[model samples]
Target: MDLRFDHLIHAVSDPERARHAFADRFGWHTVAGGEHPGFATYNALAYFGLPYIEWVGVRKPEVAAERPFGRDVLRVLRAGEGPMQFAVRTNDIVGMADRWSRAGLVHEGPIEASRVRPDGVTLRWRMLFPAQEPGKLLLPFVIEWPAPDEVRLADLRQSGLSPDPAAAPRLRAVHAVVGDLARLRRSMDAYFPGVLEPCESSEQGRGVRWTCGEVTVFVWEPAEGALRRVLDTVGERPFLAEFERTAGVRTRTAADAARRLEAAGAPVHGLWVVTSE
Candidate 1:
């Protein structure tokens, strides 16, 4: 199964607030995404071409806990906002389930789902969630869109859901904060298989890395500084993302939040544009 970085899901109490935070403070473009028809969530989208951010929010607290995705997000929102989960895309989601079975990983889905866009056009996809094991953190879910890559890219551009490819800065890597580095690597290795390696993130702490084309994922042990706070707050999650420095984005410009995260650790002002300061 060929897996690549897809959208990152940043769970929030309010989709609107998360959208404004990213656009007004972080200098990113976000658009309204429609609700999941049967799920207790809605979202706003920040499209960095194909690799995007989905700001998902709960619609009905009473119903949210009924689904696996909702239950996980609600579990983290109790600790306040953070990067709750991320996903990888593949052309074959069922094949992915087969891969997981062979690797001895438990999972759920390849279940069909769909949501209508704000423009009234309905979109559909399938998802496979790797069941988080006892005493271990969750891994990225696998998603498969019905359309081919080129066709989807064209649709995003023409429909204005995503900017032209070059108009957006590249997504460099995702910074994941985990409690046990060794355990997380074990899961990531089973999921990605034979691609994990060690990496040193100045802001996030020393951890392992695995790359899928242009996007890389770094799993870090929260340093004793500000990063430690993130661990205490959100438990194990991908707390931040780094992007290629673009016009509105800076290169470790010493912004207040950046300063604190810097003390915690990252590479060359690692978070670059992710902080609100």
Candidate 2:
């Protein structure tokens, strides 16, 4: 029952521009990830260790309308740019789904899907989406990659799809601002078990932090002021802000990252912050 953060999906209207921005700011270059057949969507991937960042966009709206998640991606793009959803990786997706279902969680599919890499290697996996509501973005969908870890990494590397471990920013934490912490915790407990630890937020509201792999997931209750405004704008989602450890100690703190990104003309919407720790 090993569950860990897999990747974060950043829905963008223009993949090339977004890719360039990320590369320019964080030295994280993205590679082609091939289109989703029958979904009218395509993606570029910036690999970072085991977890990665997926820059996804709708290629054809008319075709995308046929698929549920595809349509959701289109809608998110319509609003603005930034993280749309996050996923968790599991060794046993079927068993995990069964456990979640038994615990009274509404979800759809341990559905199988595959994508062909630019180098002609096909990658396949099964995914389970917990909860059908669009607002439930904070609830991570489960994914199980069928290929062996070595084979998958090798294939991706051969296709030049892997990130530069030395240059890429290491994800340290993921802050998820939710309207109801208790409700979200109840659902998360079934999948992550004892990972969640209670804590008090700076805003004086209840918060729980879960360590998933090298990344931490923070779920905080709704608060007043700036954070509350952000939650209202983004709705209940898994991503509020991401804290990353830079490749070098010279460039530490969110201000440093923000200054560089701003100089590069990249949008700084509080999505990622650089930390010394």
Candidate 3:
């Protein structure tokens, strides 16, 4: 499996609020996000760069059904604020799982699902989850089949309702806060090997750094004030603003990136869209 970062999911309370936040404020365009019968909810994908942002909301009770993601997705729907979960991209998901299993990081299968676009295009793929709780700084996952390129990520980037010449953002890194930096780092070291660096922290929270190619990942638990500001900013709408922010600082080190986030006062919690140099 060519393991890598896929897209990040920022679960929101009102899918519409999520949509408008991206579309109206940031000028991101939405591709027809498919509907899930099981949850009676609908979602719209804001096709950014390669990884699109999905704004998901709960559906009416009558429409929702009992299914695998039903309860959990509903939980995200209710929670409201996001940076809910992050996704990993892997071309060979099955092989990656085998590697992970050998490394002792318990994991689940690449569950299969499909999303149909308005123009009759269907995206079919499989996904896996880390053997951990959902809320924790999410672990990496895999995506396989039909390759991400065949899906034309760049095409979707051009589909937004309006385009700002400055529309594209370079997502430099994504940071999450965790309780046990050493333990988590150990898990990543065992499974992911050389990718993560030694853990670090401040009065704010524990920090662990992971580097994927040019992208940097810093997992941090910030001070109360920072956390509250993050929640408040995302509670209204999340992904778009984030995607825009991170889109700028594409190839910087995690520490350099975090400093920018600190200056921005948003902290790298949810979706971040860094601007390109």
**Cα-based lDDT for every prediction:** 0.70, 0.68, 0.55
Candidate 1 residue spans exceeding 4 A from truth: 134-137, 200-205, 245-260, 263-272, 275-277
Q: For candidate 1, lDDT tens digit of each residue in 125-153?
A: 99998778653345888899999878887
Rank order (by lDDT, best first): 1, 2, 3
RMSD of 3: 4.9
- Per-residue lDDT of model 3, residues 101-142, tens digit only: 887777767677776666666767787666755444345655
Q: Which stretches of candidate 3 lie over 4 Å from their true place?
A: 37-41, 60-66, 102-105, 134-137, 148-151, 154-167, 199-206, 223-277
- Superposed by TM-score, candidate 3 places the C-alpha of residue 120 at a distance from the truth, in angstroms, of 1.6
In candidate 1, the residue pairs with backbone N, CA or C atoms under 3 Å apart (3 or more residues apart, or in different chains) clash, namely 202-265, 202-266, 203-265, 203-266, 204-265
Q: Distance (Å) between predicted and true CA of 200, model 3?
A: 6.7
Window of ten residues with lowest summed lDDT in model 2: 248-257
lDDT of 1: 0.70
Better candidate by TM-score, 1 or 3: 1
TM-scores for candidates 1 onward, in order: 0.84, 0.82, 0.73
